[model samples]
Structures are given as structure tokens and as C-alpha cells.
Target: MEIPQANLGRGINLGNALEAPQEGEWGIVIQEYFFDKIKDVGFKAVRIPIRWSAHTETHFPYTINESFFQRVDDVINQALAGNLNVIINIHHFDELTEDPLQHEDKLYQIWRQITERYSGFPDQLIFELLNEPHEALTSDLWNQFIINLLEIIREANPERSVIIGPVQWNSISGLDSLALPQDQNLIVTFHFYSPFQFTHQGAEWVEGSDSWLGTTWEGTESEMSAITNDLDKAVRWAARNEIPLFMGEFGAYYKADYESRIRWTRFLAREAEKRDISWAYWEFGAGFGIYDIENDEWDMGLLNALIPHVLVFDKDASPQSQSR
Candidate 1:
């Protein structure tokens, strides 16, 4: 079977998907009408990042509640109906958030359930192993544990594409340490917040990022070169292993200036094309605002700046790209 590919991370992280409405209070179902707008905005896929463990029976060992699975499935189907591929994964399912290894049995069972539940979903629905494992795990520890997880996933999902990232909260550079399982049905995944000086400038979540305040994303030739060089390294690694490389996440924080953010993304798109890698931006709305919800329209000025670099067609169909 041919492995599936995502056009770009021009996808939404379904954060508002699950909520038990209280006393007539309303919450979005993820499958709501908004996706037509998201899909129309040129997104090729949607990553339904579910935080299900909170609603699950902890004692069941990776056994997810049926209601949650059904809800997730409904959303997944919605994206598919909109002609978009789907990426589903365990996002923050690791309760400890620090030591996933300590819960090996639970982790294995979690993946087993996910693999079985989505076994019938076709190529378009991809599985990301985890959403950025944290807690200062050593390289050896992560490698061995991931290899085992890959073994389990492959047992049930031999042809379904799987994604794996390194232990440093899915840092791109740390990705060098990942050794994919012997199974060929997997892709190495990593997140990009490069020039953290530029991308994560004023993210309230990041401490010591005060320096990036009031600064526009200064995407220089050097920074662009470094990014592509790093991505090229990943591509080469994949080629050696005969697997695909997926830059699963990259987005500038909302603090960056409008035009600068567009410039930065254009550079990212160009660089990804140059390296023969596929990517997904951090999101379609909120924080990244690929779509400005308040206006109910794209930041056209931003999208226009990026149009020349955005990949409207598959790389193979792309015209000869001149160097940046």
C-alpha cells in the first residue's frame, strides 16, 4: 500500500472539540459548520488532538471511554467529508506529563486501543504516537521505549502511517536521535519554533521570552538557511531509512507582526519544498490566525504575501523552483 502524505500542516488543532455542556451552555462539536470555512481556506488536513485520558477510566489501562471515541470519530469523519486528511493522536494523554516510561503498560495499551479503533480508517487518517513527550527523558530511554511502541503499533497498523517525535517536547534538533522501527510504515515527526527568538517571541507560556516583545518576525537569509539545513538533515535521514519526513508543527506566535509572520511562513514553505519535506502549520485559527475569526476572513494581506511560496500543487507537479 502507498503511504499517505499531508500537503502542509495547514490544519487546526481541535482544542474546542470536547466539552460536556453545562446547564444549556454550548460548546463546539469540532464537526460543526466552521470546518467548511477551514477547508475552504486551503487546509488539506485536520489534526484532532484529543486529550481523552481525563475522561477515561484510569484503571482500565489505555482503555478509552466509548463516548470520547465516538465523538473523535465524528470529527474525523467531518474532516474527511470536507476532502481533508485527518491526523489523530493522544495529546497530553500522559497523566504524569513528565515520565511516560513509568507507565509503559498504559502507554502500550493506549496505542493498542487507538490502532484497533482506527484500523479500518484509510490512508488519509494518520496516527501520531504522542503529542510531545516531556520530562527530560534520556536518549536511550526514549529510543528503546519508542521502538517498542512502534512494534506494537505496527502489529495492528502495518500499513497505516504513524508519526514519532523526540523527547524534548518534540524539538526539531533533538529529532536526530530518533531511530524509527524496522517497519516502513512510519514517518519521523518534529515541531519547529525556530529562532525561538522570533517565533515564540511573546508567548505568555514561554518564560524569558520578554526580549521578543514588540518585535516583528525578522526572518533573515541566515535563519532561513539554518532551518532548511536542519530540515535537509531530516530528509536525508528519512531517505537512508526509506521513510518519509513530516514537519508536523510550525507556527509563529500571534505576537509577531502581520506581515512579518507571513514573510516567515513563506520562507518556511519555500524551505520545506526545497528539502522535499511535508509540513503542517501550527493551526488554521486562534494564536496563528491563518483565519481571523473575528473578521470571518483570512488575513488576505498575509496570505497574499505567502501565495508565491505556498505549495498549491504536489511537489512533483511544481514548476522548477528557483533558489530562494
Candidate 2:
């Protein structure tokens, strides 16, 4: 059961779009060209965040809406068609995370349906069991739930690469408490947003985020050391445990200063690459995105920061082939 990590190369998330309580509710409407544009810009994979709980019933056999499933399937097909690996996960499942005891069965049932639907898809399609497990879903409880859910997923699709993260909002520090299953097809993931005040500044959803709006990441030695130390622990843990690592999410909010955002984004991305850790930027076409959907253009600064080797210029006729 080899980990399908190689396929999850440089990537970005389709956030605030389909994952919105309602598709496009967050102002990003996914068009057919979005996938092509992402691949054209050098992204090798796309993480499709989805709010499956919002679309399902709160009862036995909690079936996901068929229409919604089709829509997701279509987007996934488009991504795969563009030659990019796809990661589809249950995101914003707040209810389950709030009370895993009460909703564990429901979670298992939901995965049963999700796994069955994409069970036949190619190996490039990875299933992230849940996103950012937090709140009452403590590491201990999350461990049990992950074990249970992995059992369900394995029953239907053995050998499929499944992504799991630590509890505490998938904090890197929490990785120490994450328990791995016997399955070798697992990829342990963590989100990097150290100096949360700087990364999440001005994010409306985070409490007290507004107060940190003026903060900036200077990439000082202390800052670099702090980040390196944290990531080093994760790296060492991965090596000691013999599990592959993935930096599933990391980004500075749009409200932050542009230079600070680029600095942090580039440094974090480069650091993750240095560790051979596969990663996907927090999002695309919304806050923390490299592309502005409304303008239908890439933020050249952020794009360059994420993939410094790929050069897109006004005079370069072949954007993909042009590299620094």
C-alpha cells in the first residue's frame, strides 16, 4: 500500500467556492476554464474543499444530495482531465467536529457513500477524511473516529490514499498525538500558519483577528528559527514514525500587506519543498488565493512566490516553458 504522495505535487485549494454553505455563496463561481488555468499556471494538484454536511440530511443513512454530488464529480473530472491530482474532502463539517460522539455514525455513513461513488476513480483521486478536525473532536476521540472511518473506507476502496490530520485545527504541534493506523496508504497532513496573528490577521471568522491586522512577517532570524523548529519537529516525527508528511494548508489572508503575504507564502512553500513535503496553498480565487476570479487573471506576485521556477511574463510566448 504505497502512499500516493508523488501525485500531490504543487497544488492549490478551490476554497470559498464549492465549500461555501452554498456553491458560489462566497463569490467564486467555478467555471470550466478554472481547472485549465490552474494547471497552466504550474499547479500539479487541486484540493476541492466541500461542505458535505450542509448538503445532507441529519438522520439515519444521511444521504448526500445527488445533484451536489454530481456537481462535485464534474469539477473533479475537469481537474483530472487537466492532468492534476485531485483531493476531495469533507470540510466545514462543524456539527460532527463539535460532537463526535453524537455524530460518529453519521460521519461513517457519509464516508460510505462518498467512498462508494469515487471508489472506481483513478489513484490520483485522494480522499481526505475530514478537514481541520477541532473543538470537541479531541485527538483521543479523533483517533477513534479516524480508525473507524478508515476501516469503512478500506472496506470499499483498499489501497486508496487517504489523508488525515491532527486534531487542534490540524496544528503541527498536535501531530505528536495523532495515532496512525496499520494502513500504509495513509498520508499525515498538517496546516502551517504559525504566528497566527500574522497569517490570519483580518480574517473575520477568527476571533480577535481584526486586532492583528497590522502585523507583518518580516522573515527575521527569530521568525525563521521558530518556523524551522516547529516544522523540524514535524519532520522528525514523520521520519521516526515512517509516515509521509503533507502541508495541507497555509496562507496569509488577503487583508494583509502584499509583501508580507508573498514573503510568508514563499518562505513556507520553499521550506515545505525542502522537506519533501507535498503541499497545497490554502485557496484559489478568493481570500488567500493566487488568482482573482473576478478579474480572470493571476496575481503574478503571488504566483511567482509559490512557484519561483515557472516564469510568466508579458513577452514570453510560452508561459509554461519560460522559467527563471
Candidate 3:
């Protein structure tokens, strides 16, 4: 099955913003202008990480608040209008990780409502099953959940390309444990943050991140080799399984040195593109963001490194100013 452009393009995640416990709580707001800005910066896709659990009723049927769903709908509509491939997923469902069995039914109920709501959307919209399943959610248990949830999604929208990642925080090695279903309309995904000490250095959210503040990705041969080896494993697995692979997230946190961050970012982007793997960077604006929402501008150095062909955003002018 050929991977559609909607599922196989350079993309960026609208992270922390919507995925936070509360929208805008993380300091980034979803605005209609933001979608246009993303398209203007040459991204072909956008991944919106949404926390549906927070807004939904915690009972049978798991009713998603109409207002919350409408807000997401508006965001999706904006992205579509800008001709961007959009991915929406269940993010930050901490309860599920804490007690998978306890929340299994609720998870199913949420998906039932989501799939039904987006049932009539165009193919440009993709559904990602869940984000970084970890902790109590073992691979075996997650695999079972995936099979069941996919069945529910397929029942509502059989042709929609659904993305599923391995357990253990979507680590590359974790791919070994994922048991993909026999559905061709599926894309396997995994996140890349190898040598985490460098990428996540000083990221307050990670334990002991402060201690790794000085770490840097100098792009040593050994470092490059490790990256290639990790990616090679995923490529081989995807080819063997005859499923397209997507690097759903990858980026160095802001604490890393600018030059080192660029080097790592460019390397990963190029390597993934070399192997024909689709990817979306970790975020738009916040933490691993490439854009600075407060300034309403892109980090041209980062942008240039990730998408070399696109013209750099001219900082001297308005945020919308651009020239090839």
C-alpha cells in the first residue's frame, strides 16, 4: 500500500499547547493564524496532541464535552484549510498508564466517540492510537489494547490511516515488542531522542535532567553510527512487515546548545528522509519548539537545518516575511 502524502510528509507537532493538562496552560495557544504560519514555513503536516480525557465525562459512553470537541474541530479545520496533513491522538492519558485494565473500557469509549465524530472527515486527517504508552502499560498489554482499539476505529472509518507505536515510550528498541495487526491501513510510528542525555538535558520535566545540562551532540562518528544502527533496525522491521514507518516525534529540548541542536536535528531529519520515513518534529512552540510563539517567528537556524530547501524566515522583518 502506498503511503499517502497526508501520512508521509515533513510535519511538526503542536505540542505542550493543547496536550497540556489544560489548553494554553503550557503557554502556547492554538490560533487560526498559527496554521497559516505553519504552512508558510513549509511544513506539509501538523500533529495536534490533544488531551481528550480531561474534558470528557468519566462514565460509560465517556461523553467528550461538545465545546472541547468543537475547539479541536476548529483547529483541524484550520489545518485542513492550509492544506496540512493533520494527526490527532489521545495524549497525556496518565490514568491509562497508571492502571491500563481499569481504564481500558474508558479508552474504548473515548475512541468510539472520536472515530464517530471524525468519521466523515477527509483522508488528510489521520488518527494516532495513543502517545508514548509507558509505565504499567506493558508491550503485551498495549498490543492487545491496540488490536481492540483499531477494531473500533476500523468499524467507523476503515480507510483512515491509523498510527500505532511500540511501548516503552516509543523507543526504537521497543519496536521489537509491538505486534501489528493485519491491517494495511496502518502506519507504524516511533519517536527518536537517542542519547537522551543530550536531547533532554535540562528539561525540567525529566528526572535528573538538571544534571545533564552541559551535554551536547557533537555528531561524533560513534554518535552517527548509533543513530544509523537504531534507524536501520526500524527500517528493516518496517520493510519486513511491509508497513511504512513514521518518526512521529524527534527534537532536542531548548536547553541544548544551539549549534549542537541544529546538528542533531538536521542529521535525524536527513536520515529519516533518506530512508523514506515520514516524521514530525517534537513541536512548534514550547520546550522543543522550532517556532517562538511569543515573538511570532521561527528559529531560522533550526528551520534551515530541518528543511534546508525552504527559505529561512527573515527576522528583521515581520514574522510573515519570507524570501527564497
Candidate 4:
């Protein structure tokens, strides 16, 4: 089972859509054109965050709704049709995070069904067992849970590449505590929103974020060093463990100053590439998006910061050649 390490390069998250309580509840319905747009703009992959828990039954078997599965299948098909690698994951299972003991079996059942359903999908399609395990789902519990989920996945899709991240919302610091099985197809992921005050400023979900509004990352010596130092931790860990790393998410929120967003986004993207760490921007069309759905245009500043003109993905080339 070879990992699609190249496919993980230069990606963006399809956030605030399927991960919401409903597909459009958070305002993005994932139109087919979105895939074309993403691919055209030089992104090699898209990490789709889905809340499978919201669509499954609570009891034994925990069957996922057939229509919901079909909808997800359609999204994957669209992405593949455009030749973009797709990474789908179980996301925002808040109940599970709050009470893993009570919801553990439910999460397994969800993945069991997902893996079996997509068992025959193309290699470009990847599975991410879970997203950002935190709260009651501590590191020890998450490590064990990952083992259980991978067993379920391997039963149906033995050679498929799967992405797994550490706990504490996939924090880089959590990497030291993570434990993984000896599986060649696994890719470890972590999220970055360092200097959280700057990145998450004015995000309504965070307490006291209002006061953090106007916070900025100016690419100053201290700020740049902070990011470099934090990312180096993940780099060192991956080198020692011999596991490929993916910065599954990183971006400044919409309310952040425009120049700061560009500076931070470009700096991080380049740094990750320099370290050979593949990354996906925090989102596509919400608070932290590179694409503007309303204007039907890209936030070119951020877009250029991420892919850059010189590094645009060559759609006509072989997959291997497309690696950054």
C-alpha cells in the first residue's frame, strides 16, 4: 500500500459545509464547479470534513442514511473527475468528543460503513478516520480508538491510504503523545493556528475573541520565528518516526487584517513546502477561505500566497511530476 504523498501537496479544506449539522446549514453546498475551481487554481487536493455522526443511527448497526451517502459519493466523484485528490474524514462528532465512552462504537460503525462503501474507489480517494480528537477523547483514548478504527478500515480497504491526526484538535504539540501502528499506508496530520489570538481573532466561536480583533501577524522576526519553531517540532517528530506529515489545516480567520492574512498564509505555505510537509489551507469559502463564493472569485492574495504563479499545478503532467 503506497501512500499518495504527492497528492497531499498544496491542498485546501472544504470546511463549514458537510461538517455542519447539514450540508448547507453553514452555507456551502459543495457545487460540482467547486472542484473544477479548486483544481484550476492549482490545489492538488481537498480535505472534505464531514460529520458522519449526524447522518447515522444511534443504535446497533448505526446505518448511515443512503441518500446522505449518495451525496457524499457525488462530491467525491466530482473531485476525482477533475483529477484532484480527495481526503474525506469524520468531522465534528461533538458527541463523541464530549463522551467517547458512550459514542465509541458509533464512530467505529460509521467508519466501517464508509470504508466498505468506498472500498473500490480510485487510489486518489483517501480516508481520514477522524478529525481533531479532543475534550473527553484524550490522547491515550484516541490512540486506542485509531487502532480500532484502522482495523475496521483495513477489513474492507486493506491498501488504502488513511490520514490520522493527534488529539487536542490536531495540535502540533500533541504529536509527542501520539502512538501509531506499524502501517505503511498511514499519514500523520496536525493543524496549525499558532499565535491563536492572531489567527482566530474575531471568531465568534472562541471566548474573548472579540477583544482579539485587529490582531495581526506581520511576518516580523518574533512572529516568523514562532511559526518556524512550532513547525520544526512536527518536522523533527516525523523524521524520527519515519511517518509522512500533513499540515491538514492552517489559515487566518476572515476578520483578520488582509495584509496580515496574506503574509501569514504565504509564509506558512512556503515554510511547510520547505520542510516537505504537505498542507491544506484552513478552508475554501467560509471564515478562512481562499475562494469567495459570493463574488465567484478567488481571494487572489491568499491564493497566490498558497500556490504562487510559478508553482501552479500542471494539470497535464503525471501525478508524480506534480509533487511540490
Candidate 5:
């Protein structure tokens, strides 16, 4: 059967917000202007990483907090109002990752509530089962979990598009181990941070990352080939499986050299587009931010790389100043 492609062209992840234990805990509150800005800047979609496990009951039934649902609803509505596609998923469920056997039921109930809540939403909304399944959750177990979760979601939303990815933090090599049911509505996703030493240099949570701080991507033939080769693996897998692919996340941390970041970002964006794959840059207004919230302006160099045709100007300059 042929599966239709999801048109998630030039998207950005609303990371470090709801995925954090709290909304503002990571210094992002998902303001209305954020969605408006991205929409105006040419982003067609927004992938929201939500930590539902943090807000649900630890026991059976696993009721989610009503207030939290409203908070998420508001964020989704804001994006929809701006005519942007939205993708929400289970994120940062550390307990489940550490002990999948013990928390299996909890994970099921979490998706049960999420699917029921959003079943009535428009088709513009997408559900990504979980983000970066790893740790104690082996490939076999993760594959089983996908089957179980899809059954639950199907009860409420039979045809809604849902995204699933391979284990090992959604690595490209992990694609060979991924097994999926014969569902045309499913899209395969993978994250790219190849040459992690360069992408994650100085990232606080990554231990020993400080030592990689000065690393840079110069877009040399070898460097470019490395990325192209990695992405090609995904392209081949999707072709064989007859599934559409989405590069769910890819970006360099702010600690990297500014010019190196732009070159890397532009190169990857173009490569993914060339392969007919859609992508969402790892984040917005945080460690890998392209927008500067403090100054209410964009990092135009990085932004232009992601969306090459957007009009660029010095936000600080007045019309008269430019004319003079």
C-alpha cells in the first residue's frame, strides 16, 4: 500500500518548554508571539515536546491534571490559529525509559488519556507516540509498546497520522531494528546529530561535553559527506518500507562557533529537502535557538539558512536611517 507524505515543510521544535518539568522551568513560556513569529518567518509546522508523565498520577487509571490539559490546549490552539501544523508527543518520561516493564501500564494510560482528549481535534494535529525511546526500553520492548499504543490511539482516532521512530535515541542505524504494523497513516522519523562532538559541544547535560567545546563544522568535503551518508541510510530504509520519513530533530548547540553553526544548519536543511524529507530544527529560543527573545529579533544568519527566501533586514535600523 502507498502511504501519503506529510507536508511538514520547514518546521521548528518548541523544545525545553512543556518538555521540562514545568512550562517556564526551562525559560520558555510559549507566548502567543512565538507562534506568530514563526508563522510569519515561513515555518509550516511546530513540533511540541510534552512531558505528560510528569503531570499524571503514578497509580492505576493515571489521570492527567485537568489544568495541564488546558495549558497544552492553549498552546496548540495558538499554533493552529496561526495556520501552522502541530505535532505533540510524549517526552521526558524518564521513569518509563529506566524501567519499561514496571511503567508499561502507566505509559499506556498516558497515551489513552492523550488520545481521548485530542480525538476531536482537526487533522492538522499529529501525535508522535514518544520521543527518543532508550535506556532500559530495548528495541523489542519499544516495538511492542508501539503496537500497544497504536491500538489505543486507533480506538479514538482511526485515521489520524501518528509518527514512530527507531530506538537508540532515534538514530539512523537503529532503523534496521524498527518493526511497524502495516499502517499507511504512520510516518517514520529519526534525529540527526552526527559528529555529536561538534553538535553537542559544551552542552551542560552531556557529561565530558566541555572538552569538545572548540569543535566546529567547516562544511569540508569529508564533513558534508558524513552527513549525506547518514541521511541516505534513512532515505533507503523509507524507500524499502514504503513509508515517508521525517527528520524530527537536528541542530547545533549555541556554544558552537556562530559561523560553523550556520554552515552546518544550512547544509543539513538543504540536504534533507533534496531527499524529499521534512524536518523540524531541534529547537527555538533556548540552547539551539534561532530567535533572540531578549532582543525580540531573529538570528538572521541562522534563520536564513533554514528558510533561504525570507526577507532579511536590520531590525534595529529605521526606514529613514536606511534611506539616508
Candidate 6:
């Protein structure tokens, strides 16, 4: 009955690749410089989420070119070499996502190939089944599809950990419908962007976003309490099932004010720690950034105020790591 418990830490998502890595950018994105920043910020882990459909479309769901797989492997090795906990997964590749519940054969084929291919990845290299499965038409449908996906992964990776989330695009509330995988190593994941009114203030893709601009994570005490309470179900489930929980994605979108972003990061870090959950903010650059990739600048003071303390950045090797 042993379960692989993930050591909590702060990390970023390496996105917009497999499609391409901004031509002339050598050696893929797992650069030492990126690791340096993560280390400089005192973060001890890195989560690389890559989208592969464009590159793997050739004989996909059954086969992918070696070049594509090699590219991804190289990036993963870089993070591991830096002594950072590296998590890589098939991101943004869920096909025909218009109706998340379609249960298409292609979807199963995709996982079958992917899980089989990456089945040998080391313990630290966790595999997330899919990323934000857009909103399934209904929770029931979403949950059922995820259940089957879990079976697919378990078939190839019995003990290796895999992460799964619910229909409402990985929202905590949607997590209610998920049933833990039979495998003890499975971790339930949900992205936290609760009370969208605050977190996604200026996010263009969100609905009714007019009044969201200029808004900050500095909502009133009542607001924070309200949002936190909404997560009670997810928290309770993790506690009862003895399955570790991970906030696979959560953060203040880049469009938000810097100060607000810092506050929101602190909020999630604090709440995550309280629940003994591992979390990775939405991204490394663009929108959600611990480091301002474009300007090569980061809100250091904000990092100080919100990071190490609020998040267990170096928990495992950290001088002083906390547990929930």
C-alpha cells in the first residue's frame, strides 16, 4: 500500500514548443540559464508542459517521429541534470476537445502510445494524462472519460504516478467527480484560478471580462475566505483517499498587475501548503511568470514576500521546508 509522495516545490511550465522553439533558440528550452533563474529564485523543481500534436501528427496515436521524442527527452534530461525535480507530460494535445466527453478512439490511442513510450521515465518524471481538458459538457461525462484514461495509463505504468483532473477545465470544484485511480501512485490534480473575478482580471478569453481589468488579487478578506472554502471538497478527498493532491496549474495571468500577481501567488502557495499539495504555477513566462522572461526581470521583493515562505520552493532539499 505504499504511495509515491511528491516533494512539494515551486516550478514553471515550459510551453509553446514541439510546434517550435522560437527559431535559432538552440538546445531546446531546458537551458542552464533557465535553471539558474529557478535556482536563483531558490526554486527546486521544474514542470515542463509541452504540446505535440503538430509535430507528432505523422502516424500519431500509434507512432511519432524519433526526432520529436528525442527533442522532448533532451529537454527533460536538462532539468534533471540541474538537480531539479522534472515533470514532463503531453500537454494541449487532447484531440477534438470541443466536447471533452466524446470518448473518441483517437484519444485512447494517444494515451496508449504516450504512456507506453514514457513508461520507463524515472520516478521524478511524472506523467499528467492531459492538460486542462477544456470544459466537458457535463461533469459526469468528464469524469467517465478521465476514468478510462486512468485505466489506459495504469495499463502501461502500474506504479508510476500519473495526474488526472475533472471536466471544468481542471477547476477544483470539478474535481468532485473524479475517482482516484486504482493505482496507489496516482495524484489528483486541479488548476486553481478561483473567483475568476480576481485571478483573471484582464484575461481576454474569459467571459464577462470587462470589469476585470485593473482588478488585483487584493480582494477583501471575505473574498479570500469564500474562494478558499470552495476548495474544501478537493481537500477532503485527498485526505480521505490517502492520495496526494497536486495543484497542477494555478496563478495570476500575466495581464494582471505585478503586485496582484505576487499576492495571488502567495495565496495559492499558502493554501497549497496547508493541504499538503504540490503545485506548479501556470507558466514560466507569458501571462504567469515567476521570472519576467521578456524583460529578464522578476519582482524579487514580491518573490521574497510570496515565494520561499508561501511556497515550499526547496522543500526536499530546502534548508527549512514545511509540511501541511
Which structure among the candidates has the greatest lDDT?
Answer: 5
Task: TM-score each candidate.
Answer: 0.83, 0.94, 0.95, 0.93, 0.95, 0.81
lDDT of 2 at 90: 90
lDDT of candidate 5 over 52-162, digit per residue (tens): 999997789999999999999999999999999899999999998999999999999999998999999998899999899998999999999999999999999999999
Report clashes for each candidate as comma-separated counts: 3, 0, 0, 0, 0, 1
Q: On residues 1-324, what C-alpha lDDT tens digit does candidate 3 reach at each position? A: 233232468999999877888897888889899888888868898999999899888788789999999999999999999999999999999999999999999899999999999999999999999999999999999999998999899998998999999999988889889998798788889999988999999988899999998888899999999999998898888877788888999999999998999999999999888888899999888889888878767887788777885664455654443322
Cα lDDT tens digits for candidate 2, 1-324: 222343478999989888889997899878889988888778998998998888888798999999999998899999999989899899998888778889888889889999999889999899999999998999899898888999899987999999999998888989989998898788988998888899889998999999998899999999888888888888888887788888889998999989988888888888878887899998887888888777666787888889886665434455533322
Ranking by lDDT: 5, 3, 4, 2, 1, 6
Q: In terms of TM-score, how similar is model 3 to the real structure?
A: 0.95
- Per-residue CA lDDT of model 1 for 1-324, tens digit only, reads 122343444555544344222111223345365567666546666776666655556674657778767777777788778877788776765554566556666777877888878788878888887778777465677787788877787787788877778878887667777765676567777788777778888777689787777676667777668877777766666666666667777778878776778778888766775665676666655666465555555555455443444322223655333213
The weakest ten consecutive residues by lDDT in model 1 span 19-28
Candidate 5 shows a clash count of: 0
lDDT (C-alpha) at residue 70 in model 1? 79
Alpha carbon lDDT of residue 41, candidate 1? 48
Runs with alpha carbons beyond 4 Å of true place in candidate 3: 1-7, 312-324
lDDT (0 to 1) per candidate = 0.67, 0.86, 0.88, 0.88, 0.90, 0.65
In candidate 1, stretches whose alpha carbon ends up further than 4 angstroms from where it belongs are 1-12, 15-31, 94-97, 304-324
Output candidate 1 Cα RMSD.
Answer: 6.3
Q: Which stretches of candidate 6 lie over 4 Å from their true place?
A: 1-5, 18-32, 58-62, 99-103, 136-138, 207-210, 309-324
With candidate 3 superimposed using the best TM-score fit, by how many Å does residue 242's alpha carbon deviate from the native?
Answer: 0.6
- List residue ranges in candidate 2 displaced over 4 A: 1-7, 313-324
After superposition on all CA atoms, how large is the RMSD of candidate 4? Answer: 4.8
Error of 5 at 74 (Å): 0.6
